[model samples]
Target: MTYRPTVRGRRLARELRRLRELQRLTLQEVADRLDWSRATVSRLETGQTRPKPNDIADLLDLYGVPSPQRDALITLAREAGQRGWWTAYADVFTGSYVALEDEASLIRTWDTQLIHGLLQTEDYARAVITAGRMLPTTEDIERRIDARKARQALLNRERAPQIHLIFDECVLKRPIGGPGVMRAQLEWLLELAERPQITIQVLPFEAREHAGLDGRFTILSFPDPADPDIAYVEGTMGDVYLESAEAIASHGERFERIMKQAMSPEDSAPLIAEAARSSP
Candidate 1:
């Protein structure tokens, strides 16, 4: 199926196209140099096909991009490839999540309500979307739910990015979709916790002190030599993308503080299991 590029994805694609033009290299010329099909290069530059690492490397060399510029391009390529499952639900969700998910090499998420998108079950996703009174038709909601399901695939990749998730105790106690849905969600969390690359923790409501109490945010870190880190904060209308060094640094510090305040993964599992037992 054809995909509509997210705003951020489109922006990145335009940047790549501009770079190519500045170098005075035609698409066919670059393709011939990389031994890749012209269509492939065209797709990458047009944001049709997501750019892969190898493709970025070849393009950088072909374009004679400097080391710093090459690294940035490669990072953008990696982010471009991260079309999260959410893209499928493009009709529902704003494009912000897809863009942020794509560029995040390491994601630190804090969930105060439903399970984080990366860990939600289909049932949980449905419940969460349906709960949104402003959402449109059921078909659109289901599409978004499915898109969220697809996004989970990234966590299962062989070289999946590191995911550190912190949840408030309310997420466990407050029944989103009800007992059955919440139970399933907890089970899914338990299953996800088994993955070596994922760390799940919960901050008990009793934890009088917590950095995340003010609000929730995610810090997305990319591989080296790229533009500095970014902070994604969501709201009712859309989301904000913060890339300034000071903003990124502040979010990083807040994430570290919240991580320290939350219970350890080892300790959090039993709590999750206990919640699951009591769920429905």
Candidate 2:
């Protein structure tokens, strides 16, 4: 199975890098000192490989980390290696986005072709999975649909993330799983818009230019100040996550401009309702 790093895995990776920097040690320097290969140290710092407790202890000793902090980091390494809910669907979620999203405190998304995954209805999700052609068999598609529905549980959790979704007006009109499915999807959007934590907007075709013309992207923010915001861009080939302060700020500005071009939640709700009625 492909490795999808959990939030704890990410946290551990970040901490390890910070510790190495604090000690003013290069990857090669650490590798030589520990009698390990540079690639091993690099992978651990990059979250491509999990760290062993003993290895972490050795690094902590070399980095001069205090006893209390060393113990905490060792415990964190163990937690980071544990699997998450998405592990069962590893074939589908080969990336770390779902794991990061699971722990996000806020999610801002912009889509031009389809509804954001978090807001998609069951029928719509099934249609999307089938259309993607990523899976070979019907059983795999069904498993993906079930996994997607399970992911929606995050919305109803006690401390749900603040979700802001902006999509192109065409998304509501482009029939996905036939008219019946499209109608249900639009109706579901209307219902979801009523939630206090969810905000929906539609960018009409009338807009000559928009910030989101570049394409779909999502920005996820965590509750912890130490966890930096992530800007995720997904494509047919693969996914890219931008974590630099500049990337996060740029995406943040882009989302604000897109929100300006899109209809407000009040206006969007009526448009969705009308589209639902027109679906056929």
Best-matching candidate per TM-score: 2
What pairs collide in candidate 1? 85-151
| Model 1 misplaced stretches (Cα beyond 4 Å) | 1-89
Candidate 1 Cα lDDT to native:
0.77
Question: Which digits, one per residue and each the tens of the lDDT, describe model 2 over residues 78-150?
Answer: 8878778888888778789999999999999999999999999999999998997677899999988888988
Candidate 2's TM-score reads 0.95
How many residue pairs clash in all the candidates, one count each? 1, 0
**Candidate 1 on 186-214: residue-level lDDT in tens?**
99899989988899999987788778877
Per-residue error at 270 for model 2, in Å?
0.4
Model 2: lowest-lDDT 10 consecutive positions: 1-10
Please report the candidate that would top lDDT against the real structure: 2
